[model samples]
Target chain A: MSTVAGSHFWGPVFALWQRDMIRFLRQKNRIIGALGAPLVFWVLIGSGVGPGFRLPGWPADMTYLAYFFPGTVVLILLFTAVFSTISVIEDRREGFLQGVLVAPVAPEAIVLGKLLGGTTLAVGQALLFCLAAPLAGVPLDAAVLARLLPALFVVGFALTGLGFLVAWPLESTQVFPAIMNVLIMPLWLLSGALFPAAADSWMRYAVAVNPVAYGTAAVRRAFYGDGASMGLVPGYGPALAVSVVFAAVMFALSVWMVRRRRGTV
Target chain B: MTVYPVETDRLRRVFGARVALDDVSFAVREGEVFGLLGPNGGGKTTLFRILSTMLAPSGGAARICSHDVEREAPAVRSCLGVVFQSPSLDPHLTVAENLRYGGNLYGLRGAPLEARMRETAEALRVADRWSERVKTLSGGLQRRVEIAKSLLPRPRVLLMDEPSTGLDPVARVDLWSIIGQLRAESAMTVVLTTHLMDEAARCDRAAILHQGKLLACDTPEALCGMIGADVLTLTGREPDRLAGRVQAEFGWAASVHDGAVRVEVPRAHEQVARIVEAFPGEILAVTAGRPTLEDVFVRLTGERLGEPFFEKAGGRRKRR
Candidate 1:
């Protein structure tokens, strides 16, 4: 077992992850599709929704575009995560995932490599979407970008891990799109992506419980200073703690599922 | 020199309520082409999956070069290569890129990786089309590239699941030639699963499996010998009635199944001539043939190989 562990733990993981990156790079259309849709949403939706939308605790003068920029970033990350998860089904159907499963690599590495590869792609999309924030009238600062980097990484990692966990039990590709549809919208809405968490007491409670809500809130705080707080609900310290915990839990579950499914191919 | 490159003992696998493989066992001597011959859904792929370390056995164990498939899978994997029944190459990548990526997976890099890629491509006759995208390559060429990718690591055992499924006759011959060369030159143990009779005939030894059971395992000649005679197939307008009449009149051992009458006779050619002469109106076609892997499979399973099962909704037999 140790010999098996040593031989496969790193080599195939790195190789598969690198291959995935290369695949993403080669498909320029997919990158554009992932980044472009969210940019359009941020611009069109933010502008359209900006005039009438105002949160209770948010500064009265804050424009809808500035208020929603952080949410859009989170939305972009969520979209990328969901899409990347759905691609696992495609990979499985294409036989590449099966090839990896049959290789000497450890199951943990398969899960980790897939998550890392997917997280990298998701983060790339998020960063590209972030580039549009300035032009959309959202303020940009070096500190915000620097602070959001680790938060985005954490969120991407968490989402990728969650994606793998969802993908493991699925037997057919047909179920993935439907599952994503059921999952993505609820997770997005409940995460306070469209409105501030402090708007409603119940919503603040719900956001506190939602894993994605913590990630979005953390990202929003990074972007707009303390103005993005959840009021008396929970501080950034607890939210960061919850996000990290959620990531760890999801990652552990994903790894376990991969190991269980490893040789049953 | 008396090494068994691949070995398994009572290997079994269960999926849900179905027993996919049951107490399967075999060994492949170095430099020999070992064939797992079974009908579709007969546990051939399941066996290959376990041997390739893609599936864990529910019972028993297997080893490649003395490394346990379950415990020492990485070491076992390093010493083996597999061509899955499904196309395993990345369709988006160029053939050269796919091969290079495979090489990289096994830790080959720099000059050695490049040299190995060139050698494999040339040997597999895919060198000229190395730069073409895999999706653009013909099915046969894609299979060759897959085989080449497997050969890159110089593995001790090469496990292929139905490797000749989509190849044309000429391509099949080419692939067989490559297998022969690989076995002869590299002394690698080549294990492949195929339901195709001719392909099974090419193997040094073959195992016939049915419904997750290993019915028989031996040299192709020995398997044919077990049936004791050549096969005489008679297709007639009324095959069932004719088969019964022929059986009653000549006291010949025969069976009517799959729209054909199968007779085992000492000299099938002479018997076929006599049957054709006697039953002129009834017989549409009379052909004498040697006992093939299909015959061996039928004899073992009590069912015709590749016959469509009418029992279930998704019962269509997959082609090899």
Candidate 2:
């Protein structure tokens, strides 16, 4: 019944993606919570740590503000992903998702549409953060923008897919916000974002196991360019590989969750 | 390979230890209005979910338009339109926006999608409310938009779950009229589940369900015919005692409905006088009329249907 090739897949995905983008642009509170709060945190934490902040293996010349800059970008992506995927719970309660579930689209189409929507919003917010990288001594040119945007997309897609996985089967926003805070908050703290993956401590193993940490390492590598080596995963290639794997796993899990419909939609 | 629009063979579903649907089986003819009729917790919802391809049967099979609902869901989906018990519109989006999104989800786009949207909206009578946000519309208006959304794909079978749950009296009348219009105009099989007896009465045929079992299936008139030609009701202080006395006095199986002794009689008007005359002072009031679908239900199962009736039917197929 489809006119264009692959429209059966892309059509629904586009509808869901456009829906989230329109909602994000129209709601000032969503934009503020996703973008504004992270910018404020970047300023406060980056300044509070000051030039006095230095790790053993890192350069003493690098200020903590420059050190925490990538963390702020990751934080922005997380907040926007959370903001966008919260609607999944709302959609379940409101019955919109049920309508989509009964449609002629595949489960992968539903997962992709929802994940891509959140990824779009999260990356959009993080792009706003990239404009201020110059304040933290990070250069901001077309080449930097080109490299940084895709890196933000990778981090955002992984985070948003994670959110969609958690949010799909949930019936309400009550426990979901708590899950984001209690469960995901720790993954962020260990993500090399705070203190360079803590060389020889128990935290080094914790950071090694966290999929989110690889994402932070990737954004760091992309933002700083060639030879930047203090990221938790060490190399850009390895970090990107791990982050891509995490993103794929999360996306796959969400699709499986949507398809496992023995009891409900 | 039966040529029915929809069919289920020995279908069953269990939620842990509780059986939501027993070995239920039925078939729907083309362009007919069929209803799954029962009270709350009667398993109609579970059956509706299976046929709509939203849930799998724990055992047996369901086919829609000759395609298996579970194994060939995508093929079945193209032939099906489903209206859920709950509202499915995005409140922030306008009616046109909701319909367009619905069309897109089914792979329709561009000029044909726009033409179909306009046609469906006009047919559902929501054309004037095209620009209004769904949240801003009245409940009845919102319901029209919902039906409009489902019809965009031109489905061959329309499955509705409690289609009139929240509608007011006037809106419900409009809703039934719309269903009637569709039946007269298109060759679409419409199946719905409802606890409302009047709604069941309106259907061309109905399947009476209770406690995961199919109690009876036939046209409403045929099902009602199971209760005699007329109903004879007598109310008094002691209804259970009166019911027993009725069975003894006349060989009719009398049932008590809401503290009234209800008996199905061949000639209710003739019997009502005979009953009052025989009972004398014990009969406070007497009334006679044709048996309704509710009367059929109460006769076959009993009102409030309580645990006593369920315990009896639990052991055997009540229809047999």
Candidate 3:
């Protein structure tokens, strides 16, 4: 099965990780665009729709701005971390990835490298959005931010893994915009990030099914504890559990996609 | 036993009903440049993929430096360096950054990696271009840097898949010169795949593959010697018709290949004038020369190596 033979694993992984970081840093426009669009959405939508956008069975005191803050964090994670995986398609097109495919390292090393790199970027951007937590009426502090870090990281990791899964076998990113619409956009929109999953609707089933819903719910729980529609998606403990499982499964699928053993790709 | 740098034992691969490779067996000796000479879809790519560990053979086995390409793939990969037809360098990264990452993947680091990169770049005549981004380098220069990057780990065998695919004539010449220099400077074995007959001639030994079958494998000189006669190629607008007429009139067997009629005969230079005169303006030009690797491949397969793939497919469909 081509299990990693030696200490050779980490070197290649680190090389890939460092290269992604370099690319992320070099493209300053990407930083502005990825973070800026989400921030603008949160400000415009949360401010314009304030107080009137309450679903049945929600906390009465929760304002739209506070309710959508974690959603904005997840949105930034989706754009910064998940979209960064499009580089895999670019790598294949540029012929850079074919070199790595033939390298001595196992394919798991590649999955880990890409996952860690994307997760780091996404989580970093999400954490930056945490500076706006006080605007959402959530008490922002060191302890709460600490809780937010791990949840944000787990959710970001899962999202990046999802990106890797899609990008692994693709030769070109020509259809990625279509995929962003059909797949990524739906995942976020239906994740109860915009609306409570616990409310009676046909999409509640979809929210219950989507792993990202639990991820969003977990992040929201970290933001406001038990008050912000905690039972709407699966509460904090069950939501975090699903997010962990989701991340693991996504990573496994990505590794299997490129492993030389089965040679399926 | 002297372990050959590359070896395949009855190697076979199949995609559904079509066998891409069939019972191919050969061993490339150490310190010599070996070539897998074949046309596109002639199983050269399938074989290259198997050896490079990008794909697995459905049956039989292949090895690199005595390690099984399938079972010991990681070990095999560690000792093997590969140059693909595509550029592996990141266009945004400078030549030096690319080399650094390339070496890091092989677990080479620090001063040793720097020394190796400089030494290999110097050997490849690309030492001065270290700071240039790969996208800024000419196609020829990028190929040199690609080779330099592969050599940083000092792999025992360097394998290339159609390394000259997109090069211009001058770049092709430059590539061969770099290959020759690499051979001269080190005992490392080099193996490359090529469909070009002239490129095959530059190899120490060439293996001719046609339609998933290994026709022959030997030194280029010895392969040419298999067809020990002068070859005359007659260019004309209608090679199929010309080949038929040459056989009907001259009573000498002639075949059509790549828009030319080819004939093998003793004293071909003398016969060329008589044939051209007999055909009168029908024959546009005639060139007589010693049999090349192309002639050897033609002799072994009875079909031209450069025949369009659709022609073979059409033949198959007709038979079906």
Candidate 4:
């Protein structure tokens, strides 16, 4: 009987994921916005900031554009992850969330299904942003691409989990956009997504505490062949470990928050 | 006889200082259409939400098919189907897809899920338009699809919240007919909430709720009988003065409320002459009719049925 119940759990998960994917495909404009915003940042902001700064600890002769490209990839993850929480609020208003909440599946599975669906869309956006890096004069190799996949997955999971955590307490969509502006922008700026982390010790300490900073570091390691330029502290191992742990913790918190809120309502 | 499909004991749900549901308890028998009749914010929706396992009660307990909602939520959820007041379908998906998703949630797959989908579509009269996107469908058709989705799992019990709110009159009749047929065929227990007296009259049994408390529970005929006599409503310029005169002269039970004068009259046609003779002002209109569920509700709560007290022009009943 337990085995039968376990088998039933995957049915709803697949259905939810498929439904989201189909919706994403149907809304071409949303897909474009998700993928296009990072490219604009790469061209407009990267050029404006490129000439004025030098990446710390990078080998000589490396272009500033090279340093900024990885940051742009992480930026895609940051923006998409934060905005995805709005979908949760939308779901709530539309009563779709209540439908799923009443399902027989565990709350954890429901959270996981939503996270996976949102992360898949974010990953697609991030990959589209990654494809433009070489055209902007950043070099890419097979080794880099190989490492980038896992890094992107970790980043996606972390951002999606964070989105779920933030969406839990929200009752309406009107408050979410304002909350995202207040929360995500500072996290992105402090995470070396636009500049090197070692510019100031205080800033470096702040980035060390930021979960997305680990994701940035991991992405930088995947893209540049060296992770030292991404942050003051080098090494993809610690960054990957931190991101994975953060994702797990946030995902658990999101599940618990949903359950707790369900109890109250 | 089969056991009760749904039973709750002193179910209470509190949000902060407000009590959404206050010690509410009721049971629904198999194959019976049970109505939770109440005005808006009267805890009918809250009770439905708790029974569907979407919201937990702060106190008391509920069971579906003998499975406790809190302890065995999974089993309860599986045993029951819910059609929320708000439309829950994805506007992006087709009718078929929506039904398929609902079926999948109940552990249905393969031929069984497909067969259920087909059966529900036919039963709901939406089989011809299964491929149409829900957004393109009319409100009535969309509601039919929602009903079809709820029926996909072949649940032992079905819970609906104001299912006819957005439906047209003809559509509502058709939907109720479908519900009656479905209950007759499957013997599934149905618990629905509505403020429509005509809809409530169709139910096998109904519980009238006002201010999060059960005012009365019984069949429609029994409820109307509790009011004793037919209702005689007289509207005129000086309703209060006229009501006082009528009450004094005839020594009849009469009350002036909600802009109308209600009198318990055995023979309303005969009483009309006495009323016209006793009152000084000209009567604008006089309505004599059989006491309905609305009268029963108004008699118990001292408020108009269906119209929420919170929405009255002046501050009326204080929120508990």
DockQ of 4: 0.52
Find the candidate with the highest DockQ and give its number. Answer: 2
Residue-by-residue lDDT tens digits, candidate 4, B90-154: 87789988888877777787888898899889988999998988889987888888888888877
Q: Pull out the clashing pairs in model 3.
A: none
The per-residue C-alpha lDDT of model 1 at residue B243 equals 85
Candidate 3, residues B193-250, lDDT tens digits: the string is 9988999999999999888999899999999999878999999888898899999988
| Candidate No. with top lDDT | 3
Error of 2 at B313 (Å): 16
The weakest ten consecutive residues by lDDT in model 4 chain B span: B311-320
Structure candidate 1, residue pairs in collision: A263-B55
The best-first sequence of candidates by DockQ reads 2, 4, 3, 1
TM-score for each of the candidates = 0.91, 0.93, 0.92, 0.93
lDDT score at residue A22, model 1, on the 0-100 scale: 79
In candidate 2, what are the lDDT values of residues B1-320, reduced to their tens digit? 54999999999999899898999999999999999998767898888888877888899999998888888887777788899888788887889889999998988889999999999999999999888888899888888888889889898999998899889999999999999999999999999998888999999999999888998999998998887579888999899999999999888888886788888778789877788888879999998998888787787666644344445446432210
Segments in model 1 whose C-alpha atoms lie over 4 Å from true places: A1-6, A49-57, A135-137, A171-173, A226-238, B1-3, B268-285, B307-314, B317-320
Taken over the whole model, the C-alpha lDDT of each candidate is 0.79, 0.83, 0.85, 0.79
Candidate 1: CAPRI quality band: acceptable
Q: Flag regions of model 4 displaced more than 4 Å.
A: A1-7, A50-53, A226-233, B277-281, B308-310, B313-320
